[model samples]
Target: MTADDRIAITDLINLHGHLTDRGDFDGLAALFTPGVVYDVSALGGGELTGLEALRAAALALGEANPVAHHVTNIVLRETADGVVHALSKGLGIMADGSAGSVTYEDTLERTPAGWRITHRVVRPRRTPLRG
Candidate 1:
């Protein structure tokens, strides 16, 4: 990917946190494709497809949603199939001051609008077992 592509993708990932923390579900959903697949099964949310499903899921959280979201360590790679894969770390701070972290695996493609996530898998960050 070109430098501009990387910056755009990075900005897109960062925008997610801002939109979500602001409870702008509509803006958040705009970051993904219409037929996006969001797999949060590791967090017991199962898989959600489509922009409507994503918006519904976020709205369903209500006050349970995190107070803030921070994303870092974004690594993007392009595959032979012309899709970009992005892996990043996400830190979510809850309203109760509790925080949790997860790994966000995302697949994105260049759409007519812009680079949008087509699929994403949110996995809990596990601590390594003691030796």
Candidate 2:
């Protein structure tokens, strides 16, 4: 990935994390298109869309559990509509110390402001058992 693409993708993901940590529903909802798809099967299934619904779901989840999301290994590719596909690994931390990590498949769109995520998917996987 080009340096600029990497930077843009990183910024978007960082902003998402920040919004998530702060429980900034309004801001997070605004980041997506009218019909954004959020798929984190660990939480539920298939596809999810609409910023309002997304915000509500996120807030509800946040209220139930204090958590942190960390992402890495971001891969960026340009899409036909000028959107950017960003793939990465994500780790989720809970308040009580329990944690889970997974591979995050995300797609972001380029806008006047910059890159904004249009879709996000996470496949949950348990930590490898140590010998």
Candidate 3:
């Protein structure tokens, strides 16, 4: 992958966190593929497919709409199929003043709309990383 590719993937990862925290569910969905698979089972939800399912899942599970999402430690790898795999940590500041953390295992592809996530697995972090 080129340097530009890496930058683009990192930006996409950051955008996901920003859009989700802002409760812009539709905007978040726009960042992914049409048949994107989102595995949130680690967060008490199942694998969600497509934009509509993603939107519904977010709305249903995210009763606490206003969240602060801090994303860090992004690492990316490009595969033979031209898809990029990104791993990042997300730390959320809940509306109720509680904090939660998860690691995002993402597969991204270069789409007509730009780089989009094709799959994402959200794994709850037992112990968050700090620096």
lDDT of each: 0.92, 0.74, 0.84
Candidate 3 per-residue lDDT over residues 21-79, each given as its tens digit: 76677787568988999998987788989988977876877666437888899999888
For residues 1-131, write the lDDT of model 2, one tens digit per residue: 46887786787776776777787877874466667788866767556677777776776666554478887777777766776777788777888888887887787876676667778887887768799
Which of 1 and 2 is the better model by TM-score?
Answer: 1
What's the lDDT for candidate 1? 0.92
Deviation of model 2 at 117, angstroms = 1.4
Candidate 2 lDDT score relative to the true structure: 0.74
Which has the better lDDT: candidate 1, or candidate 3? 1
Model 3 residue 41 CA deviation in Å: 1.2
- The TM-score between candidate 1 and the true structure equals 0.94
Model 3 regions more than 4 Å off: 127-131
Better of 2 and 3 by lDDT: 3
Deviation from native of the Cα of residue 99 in model 2, angstroms:
0.7
Clashing pairs in 1: none
Best by lDDT: 1
